[model samples]
Target chain A: MLRIEDLRVEIGGKAVLQNVNLHIPAGETHILFGPNGSGKTSLMLTIMGYSNYKVTRGRITFKGEDITYLPIHERARLGIGVSFQRPPTINGLSLRKMVEICSSDREANVDHLAEQVNLSSFLERDVNANLSGGEIKRSELLQLSAQQPDLVLLDEPESGVDLENIALLGESINALLNRGVKRSGSDVHKGMMQKRSKSALVITHTGHILDYITADRGQVLNNGVMQCSQNAREILKWIREYGYQECMTCTN
Target chain B: MYKLDSNGEVNPKDFSTEAESHDYIEDLAQIDGSDTAEFENVGVETDDSNRSATFILKDLSVVHCKSKQEGIEVLKITEAMDKYDWLKDYMWKDISPEKDIYTQQASESPGEGFFIRAEKGVVSKRPVQTCLHISKEGFAQNVHNIVIVEEGAELHVIAGCSTARHAERGLHIGVSEFYVKKGATLKYTMVHDWGEKIFVRPRTVTHVDEGGVYISNYISMKPVGSLQMNPITYLDGKDSIARFNSVLVAAGGTDMDTGSVVVLGAENARAEIISRAITTGGNIIARGSIIGNVPGVRGHLECKGLILNDGLLHAIPELEAHAPNVEMSHEAAVGKIDQREIEYLMARGLDEDEAISTIVRGFLNVDIEGLPPSLVRKLDRVIADTQDDMM
Candidate 1:
């Protein structure tokens, strides 16, 4: 559902992602593996149409529409959501208020959504203000859930979360992508079958999130270049056996 | 006559004739408005306004409102003193003993104001709503208010002050003294809405006795020429609590200087002062001070300012502790709104302006706990109205 063609992005006149091409078909979840400063965030931001990214050569198409020149809010209106690795703390905006702003349904069950991530107590608290690592992740997930975006971009959701919360975060991500096990009867599932499939591009550093999310494809990004595209588990095994340095010699 | 210096010290002004003070009062009386319609927006009942709460208009015109509740009396200061000689002792007792600029201005030509008294063991369920409005140009409304909450009594007061639209230069000086007796609780909320040429000076003082609770919420979001005020509260008895919350928005050449001082004078007394100031193309100075003088006393002061566009904001917070067992702390911050916060809100489907308005509203939202639901709703409406003006 999303396509990036010859994307060359720069930040502060320095190229961060060069000649990168990525494509994720409908209903497909792609896993991006990269080390620190490996342009993963740069690619995500470029896809999200941040002006500071300076897309010198890029044509991003989402749902067959050119969104490369779209503003951040316009892209959000077009069903795009992201969870930052280290989101900035908003001093006075409450978590529940942010959810109300993000929700497509004016009367969305924010309490239920917050309950899913165990953030009911934080609903009244400031967004990300003095929140711990896991709590920030849960808060971001809560906002993403309210957004109900078709294309979700998660930046290292498993980075700071503990083991117990990570499971909850995984379940939230699954529910957000509409890939969770259907608890409603088969009749309700049949009615939802006609809906459009959800897509996501998850960025991970440790590959720990793969334990919960079933990624269809995996790609290795290193030094502002995409080297290999292969099976999600195979790439993880390759990286484990021989670090990212070996990806330079591998064929796609 | 006397004038208060910038350092809060009283200085004698040049002698003025009695005729000059009479002329001031005459000029004030020229601005007349019994409409009470303008106050409806602030959630104050105007139809039979006196039946609900005490009503005060411009100058010394209409102040004959009687409290419907037993053990609660709401009347003009002069009337209250004339009716009950005991109230004379509380009048002008907590404010500066020597006349300052505000006090002198108020005394020279006193305007219509309320004297609210909650008798001992009485709990006033309804808030005393006071509205002070100016409708004419070049007029000054000098008011003096006294509130006495007797022992074990509870009272809530909401004061709305505003001026007519497109009005010429005007001045408002209000001197308020509050006495919260032992085990009593008093919640006071003041909302100010002034025109472009209005100058406001409000001097307030409160004395909280043993186990009394005093909560103050001050908000001024409309445009004004200039404003300067420093309200002080003394926790004079053991276990007394005093909390002050202020939210102000200065826009379009308005100059506002607001501050609060909380003194913890007795053992185990606690005080907290929190202020939030937002300036858009204007100048604002937010100051807060908390003093812990007795053992086992705790005090905290927080002042935060948000500057938008070319506006200027200054935050000055001070903390003092005298006793070795006292704990005092203060934090002051002055900066522009965070771009990331705006962008974060924008990404949530809100346009830039909408995002900005939401953030501004959030910044102004000071959660005042323990307020009645009705008062909370009224306060929310006032805040929402002010935020609409901010946008």
Candidate 2:
């Protein structure tokens, strides 16, 4: 449901992502694996239409619509949601209020959603105020769940979360992608073969999140270039065994 | 009788003109009562012909009327002294004895004020509303208000002060004293919406007895020429509590110097002072202080300021702990609204202006808990109105 054609992004007069091409068809989840400073987050932010990430060349199409020039809010309204690696703390804005703002219903059942992410007590607290890394991720996931976007972009879901909270984050991410039912072991093959409508583009450095959600495809990004696209598990295994430099040599 | 030196200290006056003072009172009386309807804009229920709460409306220096409410006795200062001998013992009992410039002016040019008392064991569900309104131009209105919540009683006082739109430059000096007796609770709320040429100086002090509670909520969301006040409170008895909360919005070149001081003097006494100031184009000096003097005392002060445009804000918070077992702390912050927060909200479906208004409203909301539901609703309405005005 997403396509990028020779996309180049520049931040603060420096090119961050160069001539990148990516495509995620409908009903599929793609994983983008890259090392540090490899333009993984820059790609996600540029696709999300952050104003600071100037698109110097090419275009991005989501569901056959040109969203490269769309504003952040417009993209959000068009069923695009993202969980940032580091979200800003909003003082005086309550977590529950933020969820309410994201929800289509003003009086949505926010308590239940927060409870799912083990954040019931934090509903009244200010958004991300004095929260730990895991807690911030949970809060972001809670908001994403409320939004129920068709295309979910997760930036480093497993980066700072503890082992104990990582399972919860995995379940929440799966639920957002409509893979929760399949993970529950009730006719998994049937659920996976039903032509899932939700799509996702998850960025990871360690590929730890692949343990929970089944990604349809994987692509390695190196030095602002997309090196290869292959089977998700095969690509992760190759990177783990041979490192990213070896992948660059193989792609060349 | 008092006189003012170049230093603005109170000095004894040898002689004064009675005719001049009488003429000031006469000018006050000349205010047509029909203008009272203008108060409706400031959240006063003017259409309520049966106005239940005790009201004190001062037009310049004249006492328009002092109405009494049930379960609470409201009397003019002179009438209170003449009616009850005990009233003499309570007047000026809690405030500072040494008169400052404002207190001296209040004494010298006396205006009609209220002596509101809630009887022992009585619970006044309806608030005692007082309005110190300035209707005339180039006049000084000096008022002295005394409030006493007797033992085991509860009272809520709502005071609204404002000036007429066309009113010229004026000065208002109010000296208020409050006494919360043993096991009593007093909730006081004051809303100020003054004209551009009005200057306000309010000197207030409160004393809380054993097991008593005192809560003061002050809101000034409209423009005023200048204001300076530092209200003080003493938690003198065991288990007594005092809380001071203020929300102010300064615009139109208004200069405000406001602060609160709370002293925790008895064991287990608790005190908190919270001030939130929002400056659009004016200047604000927000100050707060809390002192813990006895064992087991806990005190905290929080001061936050939000500057919108070319406005200036200065915050000064002080905390003192004299006893080893006492805990005192303070936090002060001044900043502009975060653009990221606005963008976050915008991405959540709100437009730019809507996002900004939401943040501003949340910043101004102090969320004083345990207030009466009706009063909370009224405060919310006033806050919403203020937000609309800001937009």
Candidate 3:
């Protein structure tokens, strides 16, 4: 449901990302493995249309409509939702109101969504104000749940999260994507998997998220180049053995 | 107040302190058209059905004055003085008439102001509302007001001051004094909506006895030629509390110099002063000061201002502690809205303008701003009831 063709991006005259071609079809989740400062966030930010991450070349198309230079809110309205790694605190703007804002024209039961992430008591708190790492993750998921975007871009959901909360976060992510009762590699769940239409691009450096959620494809982005597209498990296993250096050398 | 000296102190002398008298009216309900609209703009309830009392003064005339609630008295200043031999002791008692030219003019002027008082143990079911209106061109209106809350009593006052639409280039000086007895609470809210060319000078003083509480909120949104006021309060008895909150906006050609001062004089007394201001193209000087005079007293001062356009915004917060065991602190911040905050809100599907307005509304602690007239009235009642519950 999303397409990026040779996307090159720059920030303040410095090239941060170059020649990144990727696609995530409907009902599929892709895992992006990258090391620190490897432009994984740059790609996500460029796709979200933040002004600072200037798309210098190539184009992005969502649902077959070009959105290379769309404004942030226009893109958000056009069904592109992103989870921020470190969102800013909005004083006096309560979380309940923020969730409503994210819901836009849709009918959002904010209390019900907040209850799913164990954020019911914090609905009155300011957005992202003094929230722990896990709470922030849950709050982001709650907002996304209200938004119900067709495609979700999650950036490092496992980072800074404790072992206990990561599992709950995985469950929340799965629920958000309508992916109940994981693939399990059995013929019985094939019908259930085909009914899922919400696609996602999940970013992770360590691939620890693979233990909880199922992914259809995986791609390695070393420096600013996209390496190879392969089966999700095979890439994770290879990266676990040889690290990102192998992906960088194999990119050429 | 008008000019500035080399010492950086404000000294006002540009306008004349003289106004012609107007005819007196017995019924304020007959007032309509733009005049009534102007009154509503400043939160004045001309229909006194929901108010404990209503008092209106036009130019130098006490047009209409009445009290409807039990244990409350509202009358013209001179009539009140004539009725109570002890009331003369309350007049000009805390706010000395010799302090400034405005106070001296108010003391000597023939204009009639209002006197409102709540008897002991009487809690007001509705706020006492009053308005000081200017309707003549180049008129200078001087008014002196007094408010008293007896022991174990609670009272709320809404005082609105505005010039009529046809009036031009006038001056308004309001001199007010307040007394809160032991075990009493007084909430005072003032709204100013003067015309574009009027000069406003308000001088106020307050005293709170033991176990008494004082809450004051001042708001000025429209444009004015120049305005300056600094009201001071003394928490003289043990365990007294005082709070001052003010919100102001200085548009193009408007100049505002407003502040509040609190003195915690007794043990265990507390005080807090908060002021928020915004300037689009005019100049704004927001000031707040808190002083702790005795051991175990505490005070805090916060002043924040935002400069939206090419104008001046100066914030001065002062804290003083005279005793070693007293605690006093102050915080002042003046700058423009953060760009990152704007984009953060914009990312949530709101256009740029909508995002900025939301942030601005939040910055002003927007409870009663930009609401429909009916909603404003409803919210006012809701807030009143909520405040009652909390108290």
A best-first ranking of the candidates according to their DockQ comes to 1, 3, 2
Calculate DockQ per candidate and list them. Answer: 0.65, 0.48, 0.52
lDDT of 2: 0.79
Candidate 2, residue A79: CA error in Å?
Answer: 1.9
* TM-score for candidate 1, residues paired by index: 0.89
Q: Could you give candidate 3's per-residue lDDT for residues B186-255 as a string of tens digits?
A: 9888888887878888888999999999988887877788888999999998999998878777777888
Q: In model 2 chain A, where is the ten-residue run with the lowest total lDDT? A: A181-190
**DockQ, computed on Cα atoms, for candidate 2:** 0.48
TM-score of chain B of each: 0.85, 0.86, 0.90
- Candidate 3: tens digits of C-alpha lDDT, residues A1-252: 899999999999999989999999988899998888999988998888887999899999998989999887777788888888888777667899889988988999899889878999999988899999889989888889888888899999998899998998998898788786655335367676566668899999999988888899999888888877988889999989998878878766
CA lDDT scores, all candidates in order: 0.78, 0.79, 0.82
lDDT sort, best first? 3, 2, 1
lDDT, residue B24, model 1: 23
| Superior candidate under TM-score, 2 versus 3 | 3
Give the per-residue lDDT digits (tens) of candidate 2, residues A123-144. Answer: 9998888988889888988998
Question: For residues B1-391, could you state the per-residue lDDT of candidate 2 as single tens digits?
Answer: 2222455333222222121221222232344565555454444544333343545465634343444455688777767778999876776676653567567666666666788888899887666667777766666677788899999999887777888777756777788889999999999888787876667889898999999999998888777777888888999899999988899888756878899999899989998889899887888999998888878999889999988766889998988888888888889889988877776776666667767777877887786554445445655665566556556
